[model samples]
Target: MASTWRTRKADQKTNLAKRRSPNIAEVSIPTHFRCPISLELMKDPVTVSTGITYDRQSIETWLDMGNTTCPVTNQDLEVEDLIPNHSIRRMIQDWCVANHSYGIERIPTPKIPVTPAQASEILSGIAAASRRGETTKCRELAVKVKAFAKESERNRRCFMSHGAGRALAASFSAFAAGPLENSKTGVLEDILSALVFMHPLDEETAWHIGSPESLDSIVLILKCGDLAGRLGAVLVVKELVSANGEWVEVMANTKGLIEALVKLIKEPIFPQATKASLVATYYMVNSDVERMASRFVDLGLVPVLLEILVDSEKSMCEKALAVLSGLLSCEEGREKAYEHALTMPVLVKKMFRVSDMATEFVVSALWKLCKNYNEEEAEEGGRRGESLVEALQVGAFQKLLLLLQVGCSGSAKEKATDLLKLLNGYRGRAECIDTMDFKGLKRPF
Candidate 1:
């Protein structure tokens, strides 16, 4: 441990130097001086079988995590053995001594990591506790595991190696299997929080959590839990879907699951939750199934997305536009979009307001609605003509002309040109016209 005064003196001097120079790259730290795991000065350097050196503590933690491959080399480790790199440690110590005036403190030797036998014993204990339905001990173990995992990348692997992730998953299963009493909610929360750190979860672990009961629990959290719980559920769902989307599709297709996700977007939650929901929804909908599109419409997804498009930040607007475009491609989706008052105007208005991505998506949405228009109803000036008429009334034609004249992407210009030609027939124009002002238009044909 560093002495208080010494640590304070070092920090104060460092701060003073930063205040003086701001860009302190003039006195650069050597690359070899830093540990790959912590990116700090390495006190106890050690070499793995892959011939790459890392801090002893970091490599040990990594091995303890159950990772059989070297983090730096990505090669399979011959064994979990790590040799002390005494020469590199001495070099770091000497450099620190030489730079003493610059507030550099020599790094102290790191402590030994827990042995394999000891790690196995801890995991066995947790597993046994889980089997006995000891929720309190399970929660405590999860908290400790998450704490360790958060300390460094190496620690995460180490914690996972000890079957902590499986134990946490089991704890969740146990908690979810029982009644969701207020007292047990905290334990569930702790377990979920721990699971968040073990991202890109393996297929087996994902299979365990992607069960119907577990998915229902996650959806319930999205509905009733706090921000952290909702965010955790969203991330966990994303991971599960990514690991095995077909498995998640079965859960995502359920009305309750779809409704909960749509409701999440309508809620005044932060954009992270909303963004995650969008991605999960996109992944679930990325199939040739018609029900996916209809499900979004049945749950009133268009209007919710319209609201999101209006006030959402730029990135959110892009995602909302993409999902909206996908939904509009289906016949039912087009009908649902036409039902909304702001859908046409918002789609047209966003054509030039956001980025190129937004522009392309908005135009695609318009093209879909136009391509799917009922010819008989359009000729009769019925409900099918409402969207086309609204597009004209809202100056969408003017925007498309402007995009083509001012130079847009090939795809955008292509779709815009096709839409312009299609609209000309509806307006009784004899030939294509480059018109902007929507007011003074007679049957120029």
Candidate 2:
């Protein structure tokens, strides 16, 4: 039956291919006409509005050489204009013929039904099954779990059930350290990431009792050797260190965490995993944003930040923006560092990307980074003080001005206005530090 169907399909395509070009699309190839590297269509097409074109052979050569210059106009295609090769042209034609012959579109691929909760449940079940030497059962469950966990945690409130949440995490850890220790199967990183990093346990959730003290668990989990475990551990540590740490103290203790964090950042497995680690390191270190700025600069974190900023796939730019904020806070040669930051246009471009500039912590950071260098200056102070003033002045005053004049409906705008007053001079800066508003701000942007 299959062979007969394929033969009929071949006959149908032969009929279509033999027929004259359909009225669906038209072409009038000229002397200098060629296929666009982008559309790959042959026509008397006008050169792009950008005013660039090339010859027929030139177009083919460019299409062959991956040159994005317009065939007739000779203008180079922009980063945004460069189109991918026509990958599915043949497949599309086959579909057209097959559809005209078969009279039905292809059935959609069956979606694998798996939630994060379900994924975690499977991992837990695997550990339970593996412990009793149930290899077959473990393999069966693993087979059903798809290549990746796509579902996000549905409710932040779910993790508020501190007892169940902690117990579930502990149990997952136990499984990894116990029977699964020797199993050649993959370590349970996805499961753990879903458990720890997902919605249930954010800062406001406040269900877990592990503030600062539970730091060891994350380290242990990372050491246990699973991507989920490592990420989970990193999340836990990040949450813990941040439960409370002054910037100076985080930077003061930076040495102890650097080696461990560097090891995590260098890991090749997951870019998100490495990014989370470096960002956490960038976050965990306590310093006047100035004090630790040079170390990260010396360690060559600037270029890595630019790389993450341009990658739009992951939300990694948030962290990269943060590291930029911290770098802006540095006083010593801050302009040079700012110059280096301009290398990637994305970071500067994306600063005002948030909805509420006043309340969005990164916005304030961007505010500081974007300002006129002198008026926002704080060079008279120590490295830390200078960095802080730089942060306040870096376009923050302008954002604050906009906030004050235009105003925001949210309370964060009021808070930002309040924070802005502090930047006006030492007295206001002292007032900002002396006031209570600064406490909740340490972790956000």
Candidate 3:
């Protein structure tokens, strides 16, 4: 009996192997199942008005590239007239299943893109929920909208076209204006999560969120919400400032907003948040707007930026130096930078070590600090500040010389040349000589 059972099991294993061992090349795919444009099997086949079927993605690409005719028929085609060929799609699935032994995997059903009408209906529901103080209902609808945005690029474009950005902004504004409660935090997070998908916000929507109430809400989130929420808030600020330059002033004026942004850099929660905060801060201060620069300086943005330059990666270092350079334009900014212990050393350390843009910014900042360091002051019995001496102490003189030799931008080279001339006055000072490391060589003095 045992021998007979073993023979039966062996026969079953042989049958299974035979079923799984079809040569893929021997099985020919039907030509009709292939997309005329892609020349591959159709996954989501749709028929155009010209009575020709093509893969949906391929046809969409064709139309998006400004072609009004079908690829195969060369007939006038309207994108809206493309209809899903359900029968053909079902047949394709069946064929894949039959060809399972040839390593053919069945394509899953494609998600239907959200129509403008559907997006409008969802936004209306969210608005009604907000009006009735229905936080739970609002959260539910917001999650649904977020899912649609995440489903595909087409759905996100639909949502943006149908005022989803404005509606979400209004919901967030209401939440910010409402009482702060633990139960409502989920609603805020959901709204922010959805809003994040609505990038490149339209001008009106950007202005809508740039309001004082909405700005305050963002600040509140940065202070209290979780990491995702804080990140979303900072990203929104970045988008807003980018979309409209006027919003930068409004953001700069918002109470605690600058402080909150600076704090994110000081004690970073995540890299995205830190970088976004840096970009936002750079925009706000990168103007002749002395008030904005002063605000950043007063909030101690300079030291935090110098600290970032010490250990941050290349991109982060670039942004930090950009913001620091902008801040140095103001009197208070220059004074604050002069006070920091790490300012001179950090600036010199980043010169040739980072990219050219970073080197340029470093050179510009050093020029700003030391351009006024007059040799005439020392000759007139007046004191020369420690900034120039500190520059030499940290090997700024050597770095600048190397920077000029290797070549740099026109502006950067000019600034570096001027910096070399200024620091030359302090090269032989006894204090600089004592603090500077000469390695194995004698002092130039």
> lDDT of each structure?
0.74, 0.46, 0.84
Give one digit per residue, the lDDT tens place, for model 1 in 1-445.
Answer: 5699899999999999777644433456789878888787777898887778887767666776788888887898743568778889889888877766666777775544544565566667667766787778877776776676776665666667766667667667767775667766766777788889887677666766776667778778878887878887887886776567576567655447777778877784878888878877776666555578788777888888887886678999998988888887677888777777777667877887789999999888898888756678877876558778777767777788888888878888888998898776666422233333323432212
User: Which candidate ranks first by lDDT, i.e. highest?
Assistant: 3
Off by over 4 Å in 1: 1-123, 160-165, 252-255, 286-290, 330-332, 352-360, 374-376, 392-417, 426-445
RMSD of 3: 7.8
Encode model 3's per-residue lDDT on 1-445: one tens digit a residue.
Answer: 9999999999999999878887677888899999999989999999999899999989988998999998888889987777899999999999999988798899888877777788999999998888777889999999999899999887888898888888988887777675777777778778888998898888767766777877887888888788888998899998888666778878877888888998999899999899999999989888544488888888878877876886889999999999999988888888878777777777887887779889899999998887777766656743236777777877888888998889999998998899888888678872443323324332212
Provide the lowest-lDDT 10-residue window in model 2: 151-160
State every prediction's TM-score relative to the real structure: 0.68, 0.40, 0.77
Name the weakest run of 10 consecutive residues (lDDT summed) in model 3.
435-444
Q: What does the lDDT read for residue 437 in candidate 2?
A: 26
Instruction: Rank the candidate models, highest TM-score first.
Output: 3, 1, 2
Most TM-score-accurate candidate: 3
Where model 3 places Cα greater than 4 Å from the true spot, the runs are 1-47, 51-55, 82-110, 178-184, 288-290, 339-341, 376-385, 393-410, 425-445
Going through the candidates in the order shown, the clash numbers are 4, 23, 0
Q: Write the per-residue lDDT of candidate 2 for residues 131-245, one digit (tens) a residue.
A: 6655456545544432332321222222223232453343334444433344522434433454453333444323332322223334444665566557666665565445555
| Model with the higher TM-score, candidate 1 or 2 | 1
